[model samples]
Target: MTEPADIPSPERVLDAGALRALAHPLRVRMYDILSQFGPQTASSLAQLTGESSGATSYHLRALAKHDLIREVAGRGSARERWWERPRGSVSFTNPAVMKTPSGRAATQVIMSEFLNRRHQQLMRYVGDSIKTPEDLYDAAAVISSTTIRVTEEQARELAEQLTKVLSDASDRFRDQEGEGVVPFSLRVDLFPLPPESN
Candidate 1:
């Protein structure tokens, strides 16, 4: 199990090569699935994602090269090799280390693929459960905008507070052992006005 309070920000932007390794849609799908389901064999993932064993194995290797996934211990013959995500969550700097045009393209492809997979998952959950009451589904949404007059220092402090709150919440659920049917996401984003507007 992971500790929410221990979640760490990315210390360095991913290099072009690492980003390229992760630039595939299938790879992103594999990462997301493994992150949520724990360690799984290539055959099992292929079955779940409707991809061939060879393809899944190839992508899993690529993800491993990027330190995004790794093989877990198991037996031989009937023994299946398993894989898992390196972390519960990942965050990175805006300008990744892309030394060339191809590198930039690869980064774009990977990010787009990851985002699309997330969107699909969200849509599926919403479609299946939107009609259910909040108590039944454990779902809630709040939209609020604030007009604040604050300096850059204040904004940074606010961001830190928000991150701490989220980390605390994630920690609270880290050890949940099949006690409930609730699935939830705690997403938070903060952005400042563009230079011209500012």
Candidate 2:
């Protein structure tokens, strides 16, 4: 399918090489920071991650080698370079990637880590929610779910609708240049739960 010019693109299906490059927890953390805050230097990431600048530089180069991230042109001097992801996000949507045993394993590892990170962030917010402005506390808090019988088609449709709404909202606010804006994370997971008796 052709990618549209305006909207944020769906994640490119990862090849084995790209998946392997991005499989590290620290590297994925670097990617997350870049996604949230735009261009950053390896040293800055190193400070946030508590790694040496040298190590962060090494990982950043690996990410660039696989084209998952790239160096921002003319952004820094000889000692430091800026890095950013061309696409703000990515996914392992290609069937080919999962067809290989290593690819499947790596994909699962990354996906699990991503979800685990999300849950951690959610917990952090919950802890801090009480201290936040009341308006933000009221308007920005929600965590509710339910279980109901649904055909496969119905489930797929519901997921798609939710995704479309989130995508539209993201498109409206992406790449802002104005001040007083905060970076927010949105997590939407939809999968059948284990049987009630299990």
Tens digits of per-residue lDDT for model 1, 1-198: 332545554333566666777777788788878866667888999999999998898888888887877776453234567787754445422364555678768877877887777778767766666666564346564435676778999989999999888867655664356766354655566778666763
Q: Residues 1-198, candidate 2: write the lDDT tens digits.
A: 212437676646778898888888988788778877778998899888899999999999999999888888877988888888775346654578888888888888787776777788888877677677674556655777778789999999999998888777666666666687787887677898886784
TM-score of every model versus the real structure: 0.71, 0.87
Clash count for each candidate, listed in order shown: 0, 0
User: Candidate 2 clash total?
Assistant: 0
* Whole-model alpha-carbon lDDT for candidate 2: 0.79
Distance from true location, Cα of 161 in model 1, Å? 2.6
Model 2 stretches with alpha carbons more than 4 Å out: 1-10, 131-139, 196-198
Q: How close is candidate 2 to the true structure, as a TM-score?
A: 0.87
